[model samples]
Target chain A: MISALQSVPFESVLAGGLLIGFAALLLFAFNGRIAGVCGITFSLIKHHPTLPSMTWRWLFLGGLVAGTLLYHFLTNTPFPEPPNNSLPLLIGGGLLVGYGTSMGSGCTSGHGVCGIARFSTRSITATACFMAAGIVSLFVFKHLFGWSI
Target chain B: MNQKIIALLAGLLFGAGLAASGMNDSNVVQGFLDVSGDWNPSLMFVMAAALMVTIPGFQYFLRRKPIFAQGFQLPSLKSIDRQLVIGAIIFGAGWGLVGLCPGPAIAALGYLNWEGVVFVLAMLAGAKLRQVQTT
Candidate 1:
């Protein structure tokens, strides 16, 4: 476990967190919006009645793709190979994520970061539930069944 | 126009953060989840640091009206209902299986792979199905 810690790059992780926080700050300060990716995606597909406009969602998502490409370009970091999981696994997981986030009303970025920051009880509970579920499921699927995900 | 530009910039930063933090990699996330095995504490640090900044920033920002919009748009629902818990658990199971959520899945598109494309499409389809059910 300690050896695993050694491989975990602290510098990049810290930088990434700061960047994410700052990004959320920018959105909240300037645009009065939470930088929740799942919510943003869902709103794009189905317009929310209360929101002002849809263009920002497209631009924000576009920026996500562009930002990733920019990181690889500037840092010359090679993209990790796609997991060896089967197509069905990928589709099934994706479907659950989409449906669950929509039903639950947020994902990690929404509830974990933005909602938690605001001291929202619902977000807090959701975060705990997801974290617990993730741990248990990983324990069952990966450790017990030896599934490589 | 300025709001859109800011949104774009914020997204770029957010995406870069996701890439830099190694959250874009499913294996890294899985490692974090695999506590009984070789546990990785990176995700904890990322969320901790993010909350440090976000909590302060939001506190300050909430005091004033937003520059672009008429007001700050926050979640109004506070109920800890069954749907929220059940949805989160189901989502968590999926996350455990794949180690890719909506954010990372979208960012993974930078790799320009079919898997990312397929996952994203399936995600959208699932969300649509959920919407249909709710409505």
Candidate 2:
């Protein structure tokens, strides 16, 4: 863990934070959207493929992949080794994330970033709940069940 | 056209930021969540710094209409309801298990890794389940 932190320079993290904020600002200022990834993903599912409104969603998501590609191209950094979780574990985790975000109406970016920025009580509460839940889950999974990361 | 362009650019920047900050790495996120172990505080720093920019930026933007859209399309639901808590708990648990939240998961697809593909498909299925239940 310490090694991971040490591996990614502090400047990169800070710069990334600023870039994220700037990105949020760009979306809000121009499109009046919250820049919530889960919400966008949900909408992509809900709307018909040919819907005009779906255009932006598709573009944004495409951009997400492209941006990562750009990063790799620019830095020549190799992808991190994918975790060795079982198929069942991965499927279960994905299911929880998808369903929970839908029910909760947001995820980390929606609730943790945009919502918190707006100082919404709901966002704050949601963020707290998830953070606590993550902590508990990690402790139980790794410490008790002995799941390796 | 302009709106679409901005959305694409924003998404691009967002993805780049996630990649740069090491948020796309499951190990880093898992390390952060491992409170009872050798906890990594990088995520905290990311959130704090992000808040520093967003708090003020959102405040300024909220005061006026957006440049392209007629009005801000903000979430109207304000109540701290049970659904929100339960859903967040479930999401967090999943996040802890995989250390791959929505944004990072999407960004990681650039690697063309099979894990990212599998997780995303499963996530979509989960979301489909929610849709079925509601509708």
Candidate 3:
């Protein structure tokens, strides 16, 4: 049983979920932001110089950075090293996501968590696309491209 | 004073949760994506855990009226049209190639992962490209 837990990578998942939920709760409680990555990112870009909700955006973004820093401090855990990947692939992937987020009107957080929770049809549609794209992409890369990152 | 402020606090806690749960780790996420290689079911567990909390949290919120805005703004669209299909295909492709998505990818920044930086830059670019095309 102990060995099973060790092999399962339980700590990371628990920590991740807790932080995500806490962030959602905080956003709802203090800023009422929904913690949707797509919306936040979009707003940052769409209304750049004249940030309409600058304070909340800053605070929300700040909390994201601060929460992680605090967790590391409290747990005394060393941060994990970044995964290895080519620069091109990394850049390309980001571009694709950016495009998708705009087209879909939200990313996983907006659609997956906030959207789904709110039972937003648009979010459901968007999230479905997000997940489907993820699954299909994995298949192509692994089988067709024979690429493993 | 505003609901946006409340949202920011929620986002912070959510980011913290991601860190705490270790979902920010690409390797772990990669493990889930990698069906052939040492399948890691930990992602499922993390998701389940999140759902457990979220389900109740949402229910509680539903019972009460929106404290800030008019009401809970749910997505109204129902059709799984062309945009939905195409977008999903693209998103899945990206996720498959790289085990980073918007949520976990951003959360990864807390760990100071360079890849997170790269992913975010690309993600922003992707978002911008779409905006330009649409406009």
Report the number of the highest-TM-score candidate.
2
- How accurate locally, in lDDT, is each candidate? 0.88, 0.87, 0.66
Q: Which consecutive 10 residues in model 1 chain B have the weakest lDDT in total?
A: B22-31
lDDT tens per residue, model 3, A21-84: 5556445433334667766756678734475566666666666677667767887866765765
Scored by lDDT, model 3 comes in at 0.66
Task: Return the top candidate by DockQ.
Answer: 2
lDDT of 1 by residue, B58-86 (tens): 88888888888899988888889999999
How would you order the candidates by lDDT, starting with the best?
1, 2, 3
Model 3: residues >4 Å from true position, as ranges? A1-8, A29-32, A47-50, B1-5, B68-78
Point out the worst 10-residue segment of candidate 3 chain A by lDDT: A1-10
Q: How many clashes in each structure?
A: 0, 0, 51
Query: What is the per-residue lDDT of model 1 for residues A11-121, given as tens digits with 9 covering 90 to 100?
Result: 988988888899888999899999999999987777354556888998999999899888878988778666556899889888988999998999999999999988899
Estimate, for each residue in A52-123, the C-alpha lDDT of model 2 and write its tens digit.
Answer: 889999899899888877877898867766756788999999999999999999999899989999999999
For every prediction, compared with the true complex, DockQ reads: 0.77, 0.80, 0.52
DockQ of 3: 0.52
The C-alpha TM-scores of every prediction are 0.95, 0.97, 0.84
